[model samples]
Target: MDRPVSKVREAKLELYRKKGNIHAKEVTGRFNTLRWGMVWLTQTIFYGLCWINWESAGSVRQAVLFDIAHEKLYLFGLVLWPQDALLLALVLIIAATALFLVTALAGRLFCGFACPQTVYTSIFTWIEARIEGDHLARLRLDAGPMSLRKLLIKTAKHSLWAIVAIWTAVTFVGYFTPIRELLPTVVALKTGPWEAFWLIFYAAFTYVQAGLAREAVCQHMCPYSRFQGVMFDPATSNVAYDRQRGEPRSNRRQAGQTGDCIDCGICVQVCPTGIDIRDGLQYQCINCGLCIDACDQVMEKIGAPLGLIRFASETALVAPEKHRPWYTRPRIGAYAALLLIFCGMGVWTLEHRSLLLVDVLRDRGALLRETAEGEIENAYTLKLMNLSEVPRDFIVRVAGMPGARIVGEERFTAEPGSIRPVSVTVAAPSDSSLSGIQPMLFSIQAADDRSIEVVEKSSFILP
Candidate 1:
């Protein structure tokens, strides 16, 4: 019974929704203005961040790059090795927590204002509007027979879209491959197969997802929309219609008494997702506030109060809900606490991170060899990682067994942020009683700074 009822409702929705074409009518209001502002800010950051270069030890590279080839992530002065994956995990958790907190207070704020799909869709639509004229004009053009003028107009519009999509792809890939280096490789047609593939794939993805998919992505593809309900409470604010204030809807020509709404369909016409705000909240709604802007214009023209459509909570609209401080809310407090804890841990870990790291790899070729002085010698390769921004001299020493000492060069110089491998041979007086592997320790200390040090355990051979 439930399935049948839902299918019937879906059929009704399909009838009401526009077929193929959805050119949202242009609107102007505070929300529209804010949306445009966010579009500019986000696009600027995305396109320009890869070009920022930082210099270290007379070499320059992208400030924020994840050099997968080199197994290092650079964010300005901080370089994270693969072992620092914990910090990256913390960052993801913090971002998710922050999103939850925002959702609990103002629903889908990020999705509407800052999501990549929404941003790119707005950009593409703006371009379409510019090239093809207003929403009405585009509709007319689409409906009319194809002509040379229509062909030329469409060609120009698509060319512009292609340019934007390709460039967006380039900028996105630039974070992994330095933009300066990648541009040359691209121009020379020397990009590797993988890079070329990503370039084409990403370009097509952006073009189709932003220009063609549009609201369909939000309505269907976005898993977040389905799960966002869990993040919402009755007190959660979202773009909604004040049905109590303006309902019993009527046209101007009708009646002795009427509500503020003039039955103007402008809100529906201007909605990107084509869902009427007055129909109540739906998962399809992006909460972009364009409907609010359109309804506000209608109210303004009719000399009615603004905000017939606004960011409002269900509880408040049903019955005036009493507001409380954010700290007083248990859910909000929990979200904040989680965010703070992760952030604190990240900061503390970064601050106290050691400048030197070491690993001891025993040579398997010859575990134990007899020395000329009646001693047993063990060969090893020391992997010393210099995580600091300056060069430092490191001294390696061996301990544990009696008369154990380094047989080869004990001091080595390591450059800033370089991993140096040193061949080390430890020799100790041979003991007839001791056999097989014996416990030993390798100490690596910076010649200038004792604080920068590491002690690693290894096994010494006895014969």
Candidate 2:
């Protein structure tokens, strides 16, 4: 039996539909300038931060290194340990909230302007344009027969892309492993297995995502575009086509027979995701405003007023007079309020965070031991973390039982930015009236600055 003709045709079309690649036309205007400005700003911060030097705890190192080996994070003057993970959690919360607020205020602003994918793709495409001429030239070259010149150009483009990708990977991994140390190892071709693995992995990912995947990553792979509707409202500003003025689009400029769009298709030509804006907003649109830039240029050339396509809200396009200010909208205001609250909480928590942390573990081997002097003994291990920048001596003390006291060394010096585990014996008079499990408090205080303190509670076994 044979399959139906419709089914076979549909299958063939589906297979061939995605055969070609998109070569977005080069556009220059206000939005293009703004996009490049963000690319410069973000890349400067990312690639330059690793090379910045700072002195911490008498050692010079990268200004913002997350020393995973030591389980510590160094950010300029602040040193954070695993125990300070709450601050990191708060930071993440503030970031997520900020993203939500921005999305409510302006749709896909991050994706269009500052997303790593967008930024890197812009860079990759810019390089491609510089080497391969404009979009039409590149498309012709791709469609034409293979030649030595075409092969050389293609190889050169990819070689440059690989260089940029590897550099990006190196900078990314530098945050986890000190760039200074990693650089020498890289030069020597002896990077650690994990470091090399991440560097190659990230490099390959950058190359593929920016060079090969391009718009597919934004349209199909990214979850942000799929659910952006949830964050959008009537007042959320987005790159939109003004249908009232652009409808009845025609190329010929006969008297009263034309719309502002001119039917040129430049907007579709320049779109990174290849969506026609005049058809209305679609999930494939990144809100990049390249179409706006392209349309503005075309309108300027034809002596027509600009803004045939622009950033507008659904309310503004449907009923301009009924549209309200963005910040005035209740949903936007609510998002802003929540964002501010999360930021405030993060700042407040960081401001009041403690410099010392302590954990006490009671020995499970023996509940209680009889001492030679007729005293009840209990063993414990103390894990102390010093989060400050300077070394300090910490004094340990035990309390709660009538005659409870620490028998071992009471004072110990801890190195700056280090965790120390100490074993201590707590002795109480065996003849004391206390029996069963007795509640006890273990306190550690800075010898020099007594105001710095940490207290932990544990049970003292009694026999």
TM-score against native, each model: 0.88, 0.89
**Against the hidden true structure, what lDDT does model 1 obtain?**
0.87
Which candidate has the top score in TM-score?
Answer: 2
- In candidate 1, what are the lDDT values of residues 80-147, reduced to their tens digit? 98778888888898899999999888889998899999999999999999999998788788888999
Error of 2 at 16 (Å): 15
| lDDT per residue (tens digit) for residues 1-463 in model 2 | 1235535544533333344778888889999999999999999999999889898668787889998988889888788888788889888888887888888877898999999999999999999999998988887788889999999999999999999999999999999998988888988989999999999999999999999899899989999898889999888889999888876776655556667766767787788887778889888888889999999999899888899899999999999899999767899888888878888888898887788888898887988999889888999989888888889899999887778899979998887888899898999987556789989999899998887998898888888
The Cα local distance difference test for each model comes to 0.87, 0.86
Q: Clashes in model 1: which pairs?
A: none
TM-score of decoy 1 = 0.88
Q: What TM-score should be assigned to candidate 2?
A: 0.89
Error of 1 at 323 (Å): 4.8
Q: Give every collision pair in model 2.
A: none
